[model samples]
Target: MTGGTSDARDRLIEGTRQLLWDRGYVGTSPTAIWKAAGVGQGSMYHHFDGKPDLVLAAEERAASEMQDQVRRILSGEGPAYDRIAAYLLKERDALRGCPIGRLAADPEIAGDATLREPVRETFVVLHECLVAAIEEGKAGGEFRDDLDAAGISYALSAVIQGGYTLARAEGSVVPFDRAVQGALELLRLATHEGR
Candidate 1:
């Protein structure tokens, strides 16, 4: 019974994550969530306070997963720049859009501090990871001394989050690919090839 209960809770969170990604918080109704989770209506209340509470769980799950992915690539075996490059070039469902980024545009999520905190936290982690990698690169002479780590980190972040919008707008990944490649090329220009 405990195992079944745990499974139901997990399923609800996973289903809610998918629905939230497909439909914004306002659009993802409790009916739809329970239906997607293959659980009875009471199951949601059994595991969560309500939609808001459940949405928080899903957002945290998605945020943690994205952060972990970024951390792994950023801390991986390679130069700091290479790690950043690997992150940029990492295969993703561009047309579907960024999992955490897409939520930023939702008014319902944005207005609610409790709901928006996970998204904010996710970006914070992403920014920190980029900043750390760039700072390391500068210290090791992999990047130019004239560059600003914080500035570059934010710009690179914009390239990704904005790239998702551009890709979704056109229903193609070319724009996204171009954006990442362009960002990588620009970063390369800031590198010390011979120095």
Candidate 2:
């Protein structure tokens, strides 16, 4: 309600976002969130009903941000293939993995509908955006006419998510880079024009 109250709420949400990305729902405690946000426990409880409530808000913010990034890259100028390439090749914290994708592996998130919805919706939107781009490329003769846009889109997304997993497992970004490069190579081969 007041300016200070609003600022505390924003800090709490942001703290939740970072904690969720790093520690996951189960590992992230209310105290940790409050500490990260530099707010008192009362401030946290005043802004949210509980941990799940706060996490839902954080997940929503993460999903919205991810969607905005994907939309901007996929909808940008250049050929459809170029746009898709840009989306795939964008710089990322390969070792840390995707914020939303990482949530998919969390047991807490998997069991809770309120926490999982935003994560699920984020991927749904990502797949839809990729499919649209691939379809556009196919229509423009940039990609193979016989190619399946949905299938390709799914594969591309899988590569990115899996790349993060593999990279983290190896404790290096090389695996992530290779996975992305491999995916891009496959796309180039699939497209009529070689890039």
Candidate 3:
């Protein structure tokens, strides 16, 4: 069927994504990817050049998906702080950590410019969206005009990434929730001051 080849390729990509998230780049073996994908060796080879090439494809897919989510929340209708709050409170697999952030920390992926491109872009896009939301909030009279969009964006992003690390380390989501609450409390102060 026409769907067979496409399905095999999709399976391989999905498998690679899962493996990369579960085991980092160095630990994710090509054999494991193919086996998890339920595809033959020939099929795997047919779809990707090699591990590096396949990994690149998988990273790109993950980056795109993450950026999509960031945009949806940051660009959503509401007050700027509300949008940011929605993102900070967004549901995620806290124990698993951020998939893209995990890749960014992996030496193999971090060291390779080609492989790191998507990871970098995902963060860049998140930064841009957060900045936009902050600016929008200012314009809507929801935040103080003196607030620095870039600084706030960086802090928020750091809180999120760091929250993941803390959550995984403690084997609990409390740290992540606390981090978000801290950020939200500060943002709320800005909101009231703006009024």
User: Among these predicted structures, which one has the highest lDDT?
Assistant: 1
Question: Which residue pairs show backbone clashes in model 1?
Answer: none
> Per-residue lDDT of 1-195 in model 1, one digit per residue for the tens?
699999999999999999999898988899999999999999999999999999999999999999999999997777998999999999999988888998999999999999999999999999999999998898998999888999999999999999999999999999999999999989998999833
Model 1 is weakest, by summed lDDT over 10 consecutive residues, at: 186-195
Candidate 1 wrong stretches, greater than 4 Å: none
TM-score of each: 0.97, 0.98, 0.96
Q: Model 2 segments beyond 4 Å from truth?
A: none
lDDT (C-alpha, whole model) for all candidates: 0.93, 0.92, 0.92
Q: Backbone clashes per model, in order?
A: 0, 0, 0
Q: Identify the runs in model 3 with alpha carbons over 4 angstroms from their true place.
A: 193-195
Tens-digit lDDT track for model 3 on 67-161? 99999999999888889999999998888999999998999999999999999999999999999999998898888889999999999999999
Candidate 3 shows a clash count of 0
Candidate 3 backbone collisions, by pair = none
lDDT of 2 by residue, 92-169 (tens): 999988999999989999898888899999999999999989888888889888999889989999999999999999
Worst 10 residues of 2 by lDDT: 186-195
Backbone clashes, candidate 2: 0
